[model samples]
Target: MKILFVNNGLAGGGVEKLLNDMLPLINESGNYCELLILFDDDAKYLESLRNNGVKVQIVPKKIYNKGHFQRILYIMNYIKNNDFDIVHANEFPLIYYCSIIKTILGKKMPKLVMTEHNTDNRRRHIKLSRPLEKLIYRNYDKVTSISDKVQEVLLDWLRPNDRDKYVVVYNGIAAENFRNSKPYERSDLVPEISEKDKLLCVIGSLTEQKNYFLC
Candidate 1:
């Protein structure tokens, strides 16, 4: 497939690393994978993608918040002008991008896919938002999430074309990385955790749905 990857940031973030892991497999299969960064301006971690001979494009955002508007035009032109089997995007903003543009252009849109990383993050702007999701859901061919928890949440918010459309593809670690690293002693990140006590960590953005507490 001729795939174009759209990402917001590429500073060795989890989403970028996910793309890094998948690019090798895509390259080995002799398929075309192109990288399009919405915010990245430097070659921070693009070496792997370049080394694998994948095409890269840094879509310059001439305007501020209007960058999303520019991306809509750029992507529409690319889709209308060239041949791309799939357009894969990570996170919600890019997902929202392709969804809106495809609606405006009608039938010439490419196949849309998403790799959602988190379950708790959701849209809170549109009330009774099921109608909006129902519309955008028609634009996406498939979605993959890291865990079943996320899949369940997605099924509730984002309707899919097929029941099996949402796949739980667990992220994998390389055997070489495991073999190279030695087991180190474990220590409590927080002080004074007894045997009866426990350590827990929660990860999410500063969004309100995350329910983070400060005190």
Candidate 2:
């Protein structure tokens, strides 16, 4: 299938990491995967995707918000010009755009899919004072959550009656990449730490969802 994976940007995040993991499998299976991202950045993730034969495009954004109409137009036009079987949105903003396109264009639109990467995020605070979230989500061909907990959280918010529209799809890890990673000394981060003392470490974005407070 010719799938266009849509996300906000090529940042070192869970969503980008998941795509990096899946690109090899997708390419090996003879399925083409393209990337559509908003904003331009000098991220190495772009080179990785290009090296794996994934086409990447930078869609211009006039506003910082994900649900901006200008970005929606760019996405709509790109899909309309391309022959894609699926348009998979990896974030809430892209999901909302795809949903709108599917709802408006119907049969003319590509198969819309969305993946919810986090159980709790900023999307819940959309104070648009509208009741069209469920209606928008219904337009998607399929909705996936990274885990069962994420699915439960999404369903509780969307309140979709069919229930079957949502599914659990665990994110994959690129195990081989870690095999040759250079180990860092604990003293590099902590001047008071001794080399003999074992230290606990945490990785990933230090956001609220990461729950660093628990540690």
lDDT of each candidate versus the true structure: 0.72, 0.81
Runs in model 1 with CA error above 4 Å? 41-43, 63-65, 105-107, 122-126, 159-162, 184-215
Q: Over the stretch 1-215, how does candidate 1's per-residue lDDT look in tens digits?
A: 78888877667666777777777778688887887777665556677777767666766657424766777787667667768888888876778878887788666767888887887654734558777766766677787888888788878775555767778888875567678786533353545556666555665455664566651
Predicted model with the maximum lDDT: 2
Give per-residue lDDT, candidate 2, residue 22.
87
1-215 per-residue lDDT for model 2 (tens digits): 99988888877877877787787679788888888888657555888888887888987545435548877877888999999999999776777888987877779998888988887766567845125777778888899888899899888887788798789988877678798999876777888988688786777777888788888
Best by TM-score: 2
In order of appearance, the predictions have TM-scores of 0.74, 0.84
The list of candidate 2 runs beyond 4 A from truth reads 60-67, 126-130, 178-192, 195-198
